[model samples]
Target chain A: MNLLSIIKRFAYDLQGLTFYSFRLFGKILSRPMYLMETFEQMYFLGVGSLFLVVLTGVFAGQGMALQFSIELADFGSKNYLGRVMVIAITRELGPVLCGLMVAARVAAGITAEIGSMKSSEQIEALRAFGIDPIRKLAVPRFWALMVMLPVLTIVTDFVAIYGGYIIAVYIANISGAVYWTNVTAKLTLGNFIIGLSKPFIFAAIIAIISTYMGFSTVGGTRGVGRSTTESVVACSISILFINFLFTRLLVPQIQGLL
Target chain B: MIRFENVSFSYGKEPVLRDVSFHVKPGETVVVLGISGSGKSTILKLIAGLVQPDSGRVLINGHEMTTASEDEWSRVRPKIGFVFQGGALFDSMTVGENIGFTLIEHTDKTMDEIEVTVRETLRFLNLSEDLIDILPDSLSGGMQRRVSIGRAVAAVDPMIMLYDEPTTGLDPISTEAITELILKLQSVKGVSSIVVTHQITDAFEVTNHFIVLHDGVMVFDGPGEKLVQVQDERVQSFLAPFMQSVKNIPAVCPEE
Candidate 1:
């Protein structure tokens, strides 16, 4: 398509997303909350993802610590590796990595499930029964993700710090007490706020974006596949862009206040 | 009762329905016949208030849907049950859960009461209670359709039933069973219905009242007997192929 047409299509999609998101927000607070479904999703989106998150955290932290220690050693500052690694993991790497990874896994799954429902006419069936599909399906998943992602991020953050310790003290020959002290001393309340808060924002955006894509699905099984793909791509890009936006907008104000 | 007056609809610029006017009375069954892409299912969607008409009025029990708010539509929607072509059972849910979905969502019935109602609905639909706890995907095509019907009626017991291609892509036995259920729902339950199907034989078996649509236009609206007599080129062509196939069948076995 031409640039003009692409721009127009993007505008159209944004308008649709805005309307769908607002309607979903209304249902998120409506009565007759589906508590069981939310808990089930918590099991699926949160607990189900524990192993993957831990594995990601370990590898990421190990790699960062290894590279940082090697560079700092050349300058005779290797002892500061723990402090720098902790700050990086908590302030930036932890949230963004966790958000992107969960966005890929959870967002894709939600889109595929709901897209299949949309294609199968189950969504329409829900409506014909006077039951809101958004309230029934999306609301539960939305709330579950919002509650689960921060908890997952916390797990990722601690595990990553531990992973850094393993690499620094054992592999890099740094003292364990010094490393632990530096890691703990570097973690500020503001850093924790930023770390925990990004996951919540990511969770909300991912939930809404994925559900919106699912609802917009047309065609059939192929359409389900298309929407699932679109949602994963959209969600990953959104997480990155929004992470940058959050850092640019919030970090300064938070630091200034501190 | 459901009524549509000069209703027109389009997806983008491609008109799916145009100036269509028809009414289904209480306890009456009106079968809408059209070929593929002829806007047959669109009529049922309109009746269920799933889509809005661009230029005309749709009334459900004297409530004009064109100007009605979403709250008003919600109040009107429960009186109708939609059985989709593929059954559309929530595959993630067991058969009992699927049947009990509307009840759980809309009614104040306790879990035990809902279980009782689901069992009764399964019995009502002639399905084995053994199938209740199994996922709908594990069931056969015909069984899934029956479970969908059970789900539709298990809840508030909607007075109006909407069936879209109720027997498409089914074996003859399953086709017969669904037609029988449709007839039973009409006569036994006294539920008003608007059935949309391309299966002329199935439509004829279920209802004498008919509405024929072609190219987004209503070609014929009358009884089965009158539909057979319609001579409009579009109407004749639509009915002739099916009628000829029936007529071409030999009366006796070829082995004889």
Candidate 2:
């Protein structure tokens, strides 16, 4: 394709995404909510992702702490490792890492599920019965992700702190009291808010991007696989890029509040 | 109940339907016979408001579907039942859930009431109640089609029914079963229908009025008996291979 065609296709895709996002938002706010499906998705997207998110958090925390201890030891400031670890994990790693994991697991699954439904004509069947597929499928998943991602981020934040604590006290030979004091002293309420809020944006990105990919799927099973791959890649990259944007936009404002 | 007046539709630039026009009146069963890619299924999709024509009009129960808004389309959709070629049952849902999906989503009916209605609908479609809780993947192809029909008729008695190749790949017995079901739905339930199929025998079995689409044009439109008698070379060549078998069975076109 030529540059003009490529640009035109990109514009078309952007327009499609914007329209789909608006429809999703409208359906979500409409009456006769599918509470049963929404709660089911909450269990699936939130509680179902607990083990994976926890595993990611623990390893990421331990890895960051180990790297920080090695670097700080050069300056005889190994005692400050806990403070740095907690701040980094809570302010950035906790939300982004958790978002990435959920994006891979939950977002890909949502895309595959809905993509298969589209391929099999089940989505069209929903329409044949006067049921909007977005309302029935996307809305529940969207609401569930929005509600659950922050909760999961909070869980990851605490778990990562404990993981850091384990590494600081045992591996680095820092006093447990000093580590706890530094960890608690470094983080403010603004940091917590920033960390928790990132997942909300990430959740929206994952839900909308994944659902959009699924809905646009064609060509049966192969199309479903392509959609799943596209959803994961798009959501993962979007989360990373948006993380930087959010930090740049929100961090200064949050620091000002403190 | 369904009318297509000078409708023309295309996929991007390649036209699929070209100024095709036909009407299916209440209690009438019209079968659209065409080779693959002749835009047979497009007609059903247009009637279901799943696809809009590029020009002219598609009317379902006198409502102009081409210009209708989303809410307006939704209001008209329930009045028509569409049975997709592949059954299109929700794979994640059980047979009962698939059949009762519309009721559970749209109606104020209690679970007990829904279950009762589901059971009755299944009975009407000749499906066993024991298969209710099983997922659609576990069912046979023919069984899945039956469940699809059950789902279509479960919510409300639709005024119009559109079937997109209801029996494409099936055994002779299964094909007969589906044709019988289509006939029963028309004679018993008084549901108007537009069936799109390439199966000549099946079309002859179910439809009263027949229309042939070749190269996106309606080449023939008359009674099922007249389909075999069409002078158009394309229609003749299309039916020449099936003429021997089709001739064995007596034509049974219902009186208008």
Candidate 3:
């Protein structure tokens, strides 16, 4: 396809996704809300995703500490390893990695489930029964992700920090007091806020893109598979892109706070 | 009652329905007979407000469905029940939950009230109370379709019910059960209905009025005997394959 056609198709898709997301938001604010379904989704998306987030956070923190400790020891600044780990993990790597992991797991599953429903005409059946699929299906998942991602990010931050502490004090032979002192000196409230804010944006991206893919799915089972793959790829890329934009915008304001 | 006024619809460049016009009176059952891709199911979708026609108007119980907004459509939807060809039961939910979905979401009834209605609806369809907690996939195809019908009729008494190829993939006994259920609903509930199917014998068994669609146009619109007497070569050619089976079965018209 020509570049102009490709650009046109991209714009069309963006427009559709934006329209669908706004419609879902409107339904969520309307009356007769699906409170029970929302709680169910929170359990499914939040509690179900906890183990993977914890695993990813711990390993990422340990690897960063180990690599940085060796590099800093060459310059005889090994005591600063804790400072580096705290700053990087808290302000940058923690939220972004957690978002990516959740996107891969949760977004793909949401797309596949809804796509299958669409293929089977269950989505249409919802409308036929006077129940909007957006209100019954999409709204619950959207609110659940919004409420859960920030909570997951907080848990990830604590787990990763402890993992870094383990590697710094036990493996790197840094004195525990000295390591913690440096870490506390470098970590600021502004850093924590910036990190916590990222998962919210990522959550929106994953939920909106995955649900849109499912809603627009056609054909049948083969079409559902294609939609799932597209949802995951689109969510991952959008999260990374938005992460950079958020960082660039927030970093300056956070620096002023610090 | 439902009315289609010169409704024309197409998927991209291919026309599905071209200037098709028909109406079903209150308490009447109209069976739409057509070959595959002849736009039989599209008629039901249009009546249920699932898809808009490319042109012309669709009216359900005097409400213009083609131009209704989402909220307006939602208000109108509960007055009509739709049975999809594959049953379209939510796989994640149990049979009882699936049947009670509309009641729970749209009504002020309590759980006990809803369960009583669910049990009554299931029993009316000859389904056992023991099958209530089982998932749809675990049921046989016939049972699943009956459960789908039960879901449609569980809550409020819809004024109109649309069935899209209700017996498309079923054995003889299962098809007989669904046909009997359709007839029972008509006699018991007095709801107007439009059944879309390619099955000739099934059509003869359930219809008071018969409409034939061919190449996106209406080829015949009359009673069951008149449908068999259609002189159009296209109509004759279409019915040729099913003619023997249709003759073997006694006509069980709703009017009779």
DockQ of 1: 0.79
How high is the lDDT of residue A60 in model 1? 94
Per-prediction TM-score to the true structure, in the order listed:
0.96, 0.97, 0.96
* Model 3 local distance difference test score: 0.89
The residue pairs in collision within model 2 are: none
Candidate 1 error regions (>4 Å): B245-256
Model 2, range A1-258, lDDT digits (tens) per residue? 899998998799889999999988888889757899999999999999999989988988888888898999999999998789878988899999999999999989999999999999988888888887888889999999999999999889888888888888889998999998888887778878888889999999999999999999999899999889989998999999999998998889887887
- What DockQ does predicted model 2 obtain? 0.83
Best by DockQ: 3
Could you give the TM-score of chain B for each candidate, in order?
Answer: 0.94, 0.97, 0.96
Model 3, residue B69: distance off in Å is 3.2
Give the per-residue lDDT digits (tens) of candidate 3, residues B1-256: 7889999999899999999999889999999988899999889888888788999998877878788897888788887889998999999999999999899988899999999999999899999999889999999999999999999999789888899889989999999999999989999999999999998888888875889999889998888777777789988998999988767444455554
lDDT of 2: 0.89
Q: For model 1, how does the per-residue alpha-carbon lDDT over B1-256 read when each residue is reduced to its tens digit?
A: 7888999999899999999998889988888998899999988888887888888999888878888888998887877889998999999999999999888888889999999999999998999999879999899899999999888888886889999998989999999999889888987899999899988877777777889999999999887766777789998888887986544222311111
Across all candidates, the chain A TM-score values are: 0.98, 0.96, 0.95
- Local distance difference test values of all predictions, in order: 0.89, 0.89, 0.89
Better of 1 and 2 by TM-score: 2
